[model samples]
Each structure stands twice: as C-alpha cells, then as structure tokens.
Target: MLFIQNIYLNKFLIFSSIIYLIYLNNCVYSIFECAPQETATFVRISRARLDGTPLVVSTAGHDLTCSQYCRNNIEPTTGAQRLCASFNFDGRETCYFFDDAAAPSAGQAELNPNPSANNFYYEKTCLPAVNAHEACTYRSFSFERIRKTSLEGFVKKSIQVASREQCLSACLKEKEFICRSVNYNYDTYACEMSIEDRRSKPTHLRMTVDQPVDYFDNNCLNRQNRCSQQGGNLVFVKTTQFEIKYYDHTQSVEPQESNCLQKCLDSLNTFCRSVEFSPNEKNCIVSDEDTFSRADQQGAVQNKDYYEPICVSADLSSSTCRQQAAFNRFIGVSIEGQPVATAQGVTIADCVSLCFQNLNCKSLNFDRTQSTCHIFAVGQANANVKKNPSVDFYEFNCESQFGGMALCTNEGIRFIVNTKEPYTGAIYAAEKFSTCSQVVENAKQISITFPPPNISPNCGTTIKV
Candidate 1:
C-alpha cells in the first residue's frame, strides 16, 4: 500500500507541474477542476485571465493533482476550487473556484457520486485560454439534444438536415432567408437557418466539428410571424393609383413590341428609359423619364388611357443633324478628290426625295444657302461640306433585282406581252394576166407542117389535110 501511494503521489506532482507551466504561459489567475460522475470527466477553470473565464481541465485519466493557478499568487484563496461535492478521483480530491476573489474552502466540497445524469461531454479536448484577440471555441449541437420548451418570433421552423448542401438549398429556396447565416449541428443534423437581411454572405453556412457531440438550441424556426406571407390564390400586392410606371425609350416609335425590343438592343445610348408601342397605329415612342411621378399630371399627356405621355423635352437645335447633298460631280461618289457635277436648286427634303427616286443616286448634297443640289449617281456617298463639298446628304436607293434584270436601272423596259393562237391559210393575187403574142401574131392562122405518120396503117388515112 505504501509503494502504491508513493507512485500515485509522484504522478500527481508531475501533473501539477504541467498545470503550473500552462498557467504561466496563459496568465490564468483561477482554475476549476470538475469531474462529473459521467464516464468522460470534465474539468473547468472558473476564472483565469489567460485561461478563458470558463475553462475545462482534466487529466488524460481520472487521476487527480490537475491544480490550476494564478500567476505568482500562492494565496490559497487565489488557487483553484472544487465544484459539486468533493468527489475523490483515484485518491485525490477535485477542486474548482467559486469566484475569482474568494479562497477555496476544502470543507465545502462534497462527494458528488452523480452530477446531473443528463450532463453531456463535449469532445473539445483542448481548452484554450480566452484572449481578446483570439476566437472563442464555438460549440455546435443538434436540436434533438437541445432542450427547448418554446421559441420566440424570428425563428420559424427547425428541421433535421442530412448534409450541408441540403441545408443551403433549403435556405436558398426560401425567400425569407434573403440575408442570414445558417447554423448547423452536424451531430444532430439539425439546422438553424435564420432569415435575415445580412444572410447574403456565404460564411453563414460554415460548419466545423469538435470531437464530442454538443447540444445546440435551434432559434431559426422560432418565429411566429414570417418575413413574407402567401395569400390565397392571388400572390400579388395591392397598389394605389399613385404608383409610377416605367417604360422603354424606343417604345413609342416601334410598330410592335418585338421591334421595340430590337431597337432597345441596337441603341447606343444607355440613358433610354422605357419603350411604348402601338400595333394598330404602327408607332413607337421612346422617352427618357427617369423621375416620373404619377401624382404630377399637369404636363403629362394621356394616350388612349393606356399610357400617360411624359413630355420628351429636347432641344431640336442641339440635335446632331446631317444635310442632304445635291450634286454628283462636286463630290465623287466612288473615289475622293474626283470632280463631280453640282445639281440645280432643290430643298434638302426635295433632294432626298430625288435621291430616293433615282436608281443610280447613292446620296445627294443640297445647299440650303445656294439652293443647289449634288447627287451621287454611283458608288458610296462621300460628301463633306468643308472639303469636296455637297449641300445636303441622303443614302442611295438600292432595290433588289431578279436574275440579271435591273428593275431600277431605267424606265424603258417596263412592260412585256405574250401571244398564243391557232393558224388559218388564205391566198390572194392582185395582178392581171397578159398574152405572150401581140401584132407579131398576124399569121395566127399559119399552120406549122407536121411529120407524116410512118406505117401501113397511116397510108389509108393520109388524104385529109
């Protein structure tokens, strides 16, 4: 028995020395040693500067002498105290501090054979000292183990999740969780998915594990009232007449919605606000009314009761306008610096119309001051007023043709005809016939001698003339 006692003493001394060293480094003032009657032991330091305010200390085994201390303070009062009834572990008694200032009373320690039977052992083996700069050890537990009688508003529902992916997907599907972090207990697979405005950050879903399971109170599903609610079949909000409406800038000018959409895509200006188009009228209206208000209806125009017209106030003079060119020779339609003819007097509109009518005219320049016209008959229209100048400018009329026939080339070959019918024969002569003999035929009665028939049959018949 003596030998065994000595061996235990040596072990206790060694353990105490290690605790002293830890106190030195961590600047802990108070230590708590607790061994619940449970299988896994738990030791805690009630007050330690370097040691977190609540610290756990336990030997690898249940052997005692895990003394906790404050720096340079041997005031037995400053030393660690026992918690619960002083139950002897192995042979030595476990101690804990009641408060930071009071001395530990050995008599007050009672033998606690059973500290609450339901006490759980968190698997965090390393009890780190709390520092202002350091992060506290966070315990994660599932809702199943956590005792919850009731929850307040804000947390609406609690559910057990299989994986982190399921938790995240659930949170995403819920519109209420627009901004909030999701806390999960991997042990219980219970998730506290909070719905908050700041939940957009993904860090809320992070999950870490300590060795042993811990209990977590799920406050995510505690809320009585939801952030948003679903109505019966309607799923829409009621609006007043003062609600403002927005539209696209090209909407008024486009003949159809499709055309307006296309124009919006093609426009270079980014300030275009909304588009309004009418299919019946084939008109599109594009406007920039950013600060439009429905209440301010004085200057607004109402169109067919469907839309209110916000005035498109723009400076017409400040608009970037181009003049039409009138002459061809003045500005070569193909090559630069080539001589071209100047057209006669014509207005800018008339010049454009003429250019549209002429098939060969690419563009024309009409001079407002001189009333002169310059038409581009062929090639690209390159007319500049400052340089090889023209008056006004217009693009050429290029119409598509079939086969090799140029429909717009000239006006001569405009029509064609086809014929298909049965045929009948008829003959007519218009001249009189004449005789071959005239006065020369006076010996008309003159007979011509004929050769006598040769043979015996002819000799009898010979006498007649």
Candidate 2:
C-alpha cells in the first residue's frame, strides 16, 4: 500500500508541472486572454444624442463602463433575446443604453446635434478582422457638413476612394444608376453611392455614431432637370381626338410650341387644362378639357401632342388639406387600377396635396413602405380596394371640372362666362357675325320654334347692348 501511494503522488506532480509550463508559454487564463483579440468598436460624436427610449438606464463612472454594461445587458421587455446597439452618455454620470428593438436601424436613431446639450452618442459597428487594425487617420473632407448623420439602405454601389470629393464626383459621374446621395467612410476610405436622397428616403436618414462616416446630397439637381427627368411638372401623352371644339376657350397664332404653352399658363381668366399646338399652321388652341377628364374624347391627331400637368411645381405642397375636399382615410387599404400618374419619394401629405391640386385625380394610393404616390383618375370603385397593411387610400369627394371665368370684350363691351359642364355646341364656319346680337339673331332665325336646347342651353347666352 505504501508503494502504490508513492507512485500515485509522483504521477500527480508530473501532471501539475506540465500544465503550469503550458500556461506560462501560452499566457492564457481560462477563456479570457491577456492579448487583444476581437473587440467592439464605437464612434463617438460630441454634443449629440441618439433619440430613443433607453432599454437600460444606469449610472456609470465612465463611458467605457457604460458601454460594457450595455454590451452585457439582455432585453428585459419582449422576452425575446435582443442585444444593445447604441448608448448615450450624458457627459456627467447618467448612461442610457438602447437595444435593437428601440432603434431598429441606425438611420432611425438619427442624432440631434444640440448646441446646448453636452451629450455624446455611441453605436456599435462592424469590427476589422482579428489582429487587424485600421489607422483611421484619413484627412477629413470639407464641405457643408451634416455631421453624425448617415443615409442608410440606398447604396447603389461601393468603391474605395481617397477623399470625399472623389466620392461625390463618382456619384455625379455614375451613368448606370441615378446617384443622388453618397456616404463616405473616413476609416476605411469607402465611398457608397446611393440612388435616393433625404427627400426621397427621409426615414432612412439615420445617425451613424457607430462608424466614422460623412454624408452628402447631390444638390446639383435643379428644378428643370427634375421636371424633365422625373416628370416633375408636365407629362406628355398621345391623343387622337380631333372633333373637340366647344371646350376651346381661346385660339391664337404662336410662333413656337413653347409660346403656346406659355399662353395657356398665363390665362388667369380661364382655367386651361391642356393646349393643342399645330406645327403645320402655327395655331394654338387652349381648352379646359384634358385627356383625363374627357377620356372618351381622346384620339390620335396628326403631328400633334397632348401635355397634361401631372404635378405643378408652384401649386405642389407637402401639406395635407382636408378642407378643400372630403376624403375617407383607409389606413391599411390599397386601391387597385392602372394609375393615371405616379410620383416617387413623396410623403403622405405631399401625396394628398398632389391629388387635391390635380383636376383629373379622383383618388390616391400611397405606399408607406416604399414612399411612393399613385394618382387615379378612374376605376376607384369600392371593389378596387384590397387589404394591404403598408398602403393607405384616399378618394377626393368632388366633381371633375375646370371651373373658371371667360372674358370676351369688344369696344369696351365686356362679357364674362363660366360653366361647369362638358362642351356641347355646333360650329358654324360659313356664317359671320360682327357682334353678340348678330349671333343671337342668327340663333333665333334657326331655332325660333324649338324650345331651349337641353344640352348646355346656358353655355353661349349673350345680351345685346
């Protein structure tokens, strides 16, 4: 028994000596190591605060302590496990930790830079490879700085660039995609070109306190380019209707097509919905009827094009007007039909205003998920709506008419006219009348025995003076 105990003791000593030597050489203690491995990285922005309800709020001695506290905190509310994504240090004692649920995207947690507030915002970001480090000493680009703000989810392409100017230049020169915004990383020297802007993706504008990055919008896009490229103001379509005459308010000889369009716009006395310019005759006809209000009258005419104001820049507003038209709001409903016109990167208020501004727009369908606006002229019956949680429907309760005044004056004799009905009048090319009384006399000679014409009987009434 004594011999067996001695042998066992010798075996235990040998095992202990081997384990200590291994520990000395590797310099590792349990799962924790003395040397650096992969660790979390954060971007610190001064005088800023990430806007959200804190998931875990506690007092800490330092910002690092607060960061560690957030890293270990499990979401206490939803029972489903979620990790902390951001935190706000008050520059004094309080630390506010936020989970992914509180701020789903970094863009949603946009930092509000307050001049008076002395707070620092931080967010977790992707770390470099193990044992790899970025110098993060790249020169900062100078321009109109929207500090700490990042545009998310609209990146069309990503490339390595030396400076922010090159990034912006790359976006401007991009021919494959319509680049409207750019995100440049100072640490990685990466340029991310985006197809959308803040006006297009307002909600996607997020606070990027997790990485060293800058954002810029392509303000070079002017109003004319906007009107031409995106159908910002006027939209042209083909029509063949040639028999329209009663709706014509005025006709004049124009040297150019642009002059004809300008004449229609300058008509304060009459609401001109469309204009027909004949290149062969240099004849311009301004009318109150468009292809939308009078869809049945549309037909192809030789060497003539029809233009409608889908969106007027002067009249378009991002404000919701409830008094002009009665609208029924369906939060989760979408109208089904071929849209008369569609506009992208607009808000709900803008969509409502667009529908109200258009004479032909009977209803509108807005996609909350995509921030798109759809205008409908016809086919908005009850059966067209479907269940869509991300869509909202609104229908304008009003009659479709170009309600305005008309002025016809000769030798200080002025006559004003107004109508709210479709045109119904016969054209007499052979007869010539000098005055309003002569026209009345001719009408009396032709239909004296007949009762008043029921179709727009009050359209061409005139008084003899």
Candidate 3:
C-alpha cells in the first residue's frame, strides 16, 4: 500500500507541474478557458431602497443599481415594488450577448429575473477572431443625413471626361466630392459630386485641411483620338442640353428624358432642353449650343436610341401680326404638326396669359368666328391654316420662348408721297389727320352736311361738320 501511494503521489505531482507550466504560458487560471454563454435576460428586485428612500432598481453593465434615490427614508408602495421586480435590462446592455429569442413581457415576473441570475442568455452569433491581449468594447458610430441643396458648390464646376465612367471616377477622387446626385448636360456633361466639409469636424480640422487632393483626369480623350482627329466628320452622336429657366418655381428645371429626369422635375425653376445617350463616348461631342443633335446614321452601336425633344412654347400671338375683321385675330407660324391652344372670350393678351399658366399647353389657336379658345396639349398636332381665315389663328413655339416675352407687333405704318422731281412729301398721321388740307377740302365740298349724331352708320357717305 505504501509503494502504491508513493507512485500515485509522483504521478499527481507530474500532472500538476504540467498544468502549472501550461497555465503560466497561456496566462489562464481557470480550469476551462471557454467563452461565456451569450444570453439576454432581466434582473428583477422588489422594494429596493437606498438611504431609506424608495429607489428605482436598474441594470447597467452587468450590475444592478438604483437609478433614482432619495435623501430621506421612504417606503416603496406595492405598485412601485411590482415595477421594480418586473423591469428588464436587455442582454445587449450587459455583455456581447445578443437577444435572439422572443423578449419577455413585464407581467411575466418568473421570466423577468431569470432564475439562473446569469447576466448573459445563450444565443447563436458569428464570432470574429480576436487577439487574446486586446480588450473587447463597443465601437462608437454615427450616420449623417444628406440633401441636394447642401451640395450646390461642388456641382457648379465644369467637369470634363472622355466617358461617364471617367466622369464618375474624377468625382470620386475629388477631396470634397461626396457623390454625384445631380448632373446637368450644358452641351458638355456636368457631374456633381457630393462631399461633406469634414473640416468642420474637430478631428479633421485639427489634423490637416491642406492635404494634397487627388482627382482622376481623362483629358477629354478616349483610348484613341478618333473624335478629335475626325473634326466634326458627321459622327453619329446623340447629345443633351440643360436650360435653367426658373430656379425657385415649381416648373423650373424640366427633365425631358431618363430616370435621372425626376431629380430636375421635382426641383424649382429647373428646365432641361433634351438628353442624348449613346453606347460609345466617341459618338457625341459636347458643344456650346444648348441643343442636342443626332446623326442620321443608324445602328452605330447596339441599344443606342434617341428620344424626341420636349419643346416648350409659352405664347405665340406676341410675335405675330394682329388684325381685326370682326374679332381680334393674329397670324403666327406653327411647327407643321405641333398642337396649339387658342383663347377667344379673353383678348389676345389674356389668351397668352392663360397659355403660360398651363403645364402641357404648347401653343394657341384662337377662332374669331365663335370667339373660342383651343389649347393643344402636344406639340405634334396638325396645324394647316391658310389666307388668315377669319376663324383661324396660328402661333409658333420659338426656342427662346421660355419664361419670357417676345415682341409680336408695333402700332404704326410708314407711308411716303412724292409729288415731283427733287421734291418729297411726308405725313405724320398723329399731327396731320385732324387738320389736313384734304380733310378741310372734303368737308367743304360735301353735298349735304349731316348731323354729328347721325354719323354712326353713314360716316363714310355723309359728311359731318
């Protein structure tokens, strides 16, 4: 028995020594260095008091404490006691454990303060490998709300690139560039990159504001200089034009094409002339004219399609001659099949005003016969009126007729009379019409002098003195 005891003691010593050495190397004192079970549970108590004051018991960082304490002694009521025992602290507040299971109600006291009293509840979650010596803690994070008006400065720049991808890349490389939210095609494509002024942040401003900024430069050249070399050689291209009409009005910028149109359509006082999209960047060249042009050649690339331009014409009568046979009349040109709107009850001035207020109205056609108004919603309506018909009126939508007025007519006619060689005669109607030699002679030579009141119906035939 003694020999067996000695052998057992020796074996035990050797095992203990091995464990001690392993523990010293790994810096572990517990029998099992396993991670704690992830869990979500509440710690509940009844009638918690501090300094004789009724206190509200709360859980914070794996510990239970009183949130509200009084300086004087106060007994907790039954209701307060119930609330204290029913309140629950989310497992996330205590440890890294996430609440994967259904949360318990405050009424369920048994489930509120888990019988196990473990701050953590077991839950399945992905665990990233962590360095043994590093401490684990929650990271502080935040989010920012961005808007269009907040990024006007970065968008106003003239961005030039060989392709849309290059344009996007350039914006990404800019220091203050946040993202491209709005792009206006002013003959050339303008891209707006949004960026927050992080210099306002204390950390960034203190660090460095003059750091070398980086940006991508395509130099407006493609992989090959075919476009520059060709020099306006009828490249089958599509283009876009942006017109800023009203900046603060509901119909300011109007997008005529693409889903990106919605951005301008919803903005105040923004209007876009047209958009031209192509599969190849070499197909189109940005120009100074606010117009989009396309080549006649078809199928230069696959899926390359062009949309017709959306023309806006405010009023047409102001640019045409107005005559009155019975009712007010005006003769204006139309774009062949473009539709027009006409007003009759109102004078030509009022008619034009109405046309300007309508969203879809492009032109006007006023009929003198019935004194009626006709508003053409689309610009593709047929208008073929001839001979200045008494019932027919026409107007054309000029490109420059956006949110402005144009001169239609002037109220005078010039006439010259020549009596002999080296002699000329001119008459100023304003001063001579009332007391001219022809008027006085015609009055004296009249056959019968008619009463002034009777000249209403027979003014031409009857002379009035």
Tell me the TM-score of each prediction against the true structure.
0.17, 0.29, 0.15
> 2 or 3, which is superior by lDDT?
2
Q: Cα deviation of 281 in candidate 3 (Å)? A: 12
Question: Which lDDT tens digits does candidate 1 get at residues 9-74?
Answer: 999999999999887534322232212321111122111111113233332221112221211122
lDDT of 2 by residue, 315-374 (tens): 333223333223545557888888877888886556755665555677888897898999
Go through the candidates in order and give the C-alpha RMSD of each one to the true structure.
40.5, 24.9, 29.6
The runs of at least 3 residues in candidate 1 whose Cα sits more than 4 Å from the true structure, single-residue gaps closed, are: 1-342, 379-390, 400-465
Give candidate 3 misplaced runs (Cα > 4 Å): 1-257, 263-274, 278-289, 292-465
Candidate 1: RMSD to truth? 40.5
In terms of TM-score, how similar is model 1 to the real structure?
A: 0.17
RMSD to native, candidate 3: 29.6
TM-score-wise, the better of 1 and 3 is 1
The runs of at least 3 residues in candidate 2 whose Cα sits more than 4 Å from the true structure, single-residue gaps closed, are: 1-144, 227-346, 349-465
Choose the strongest candidate by lDDT: 2
Error of 3 at 243 (Å): 16
lDDT of 3 by residue, 124-199 (tens): 1111222211111111100111111123244334566543333433433443423323232323455444332211
Per-candidate Cα lDDT values, in order, are 0.30, 0.53, 0.28
